[model samples]
Target: MNAEQHESGSWYWEVGSEQCPHGPEPDYDTQPEAWDIWIDRHTGSPQDVRICLDAPAGEACLQCSEDDGEMVPWESCRIREHARPKQGVVPNPGAEHQPVTVLVGTLECLDRECDEYFGDDGDEIPDMESCSHIREEQACSCQRQDDGEYSNDPCPARSLSVTGGTA
Candidate 1:
């Protein structure tokens, strides 16, 4: 997804951002094609045919000067990890069923109806700077990239969690 590849092969990967003497260096871009191949071969998820990073406007990095460019977690925009029902996957009629892991996130709403949250036409808007007062950080029950473990209130932040499912 990197429109500008700095080196022969650099897609930023785990090296998200680093603090240097010249302030935070721009997060480097990394190879995304490798992920498509890896997901398909390892997970056998038919990634090329079914998987994609869905970026809602609220989650996009609008700070970049270029309006038209590839999106891949460049500045404040972190392509959040999420999933949806895969299409074209035929279910096995005879396979035993079990509970599945379902992750739920939180959305902080205004204490009361705020006019700023709506557009001029009366429709609800998304990620407008005017509506920032109504937005809230997702309660932190996020996974730790370093340890790969789920945390509930890990440190100063932790969101709710759903149990009974194996990942």
Candidate 2:
């Protein structure tokens, strides 16, 4: 069976190999140009179709690139007018479903009030207030104890824990 696009952009397919006086005309808003439309030979109804928008200007065959890595023009390709899947046949569901894992956690950082200082390499810079270069370090306003602990106030560093999911 063959199909044609009307001037009004509607699609119609031939009833059989030979043209019938009365044919089925399916009205589609847009034309299926350049793509091969698979139709049922007996009913002249569309089953499945092949479309390749990325195909350069004249290429139409979907397997052109897969066959020889060369695009076959629509005009040059042989049109398989009678291509349709068997009626009422279901396709196989490939692959088993895998369980999805979910995780929940909190993200926290040290507050600005915390006087923790780190060097350019991310190593903790000790004794910032007593350092000779303390004047050069803008963030060095150390109020920490000599034992490297927060003096009077609690440590502002937050502890994050995973409270949910398969940890």
Q: Give the Cα error of residue 18 in candidate 2, in Å.
A: 44
For model 1, name the residue pairs that clash: 10-29, 10-30, 11-29, 11-30, 11-31, 12-29, 12-30, 140-159, 141-159, 153-158
Off by over 4 Å in 1: 1-73, 76-134, 141-167
* lDDT per residue (tens digit) for residues 71-147 in model 2: 44332223222111122322233412211121111011111112245577777666543222111111111223342
Error of 2 at 123 (Å): 87
Off by over 4 Å in 2: 1-55, 79-167
Candidate with best lDDT: 1
- Backbone clashes in each candidate structure, one number apiece? 10, 0
Query: Model 2 Cα displacement at 31 (Å)?
Result: 40
Task: Kindly list the per-residue Cα lDDT of model 1 for residues 69-139, writing each as its tens digit.
Answer: 43333322222222211223322445333222323221122221456677789987776543333322222
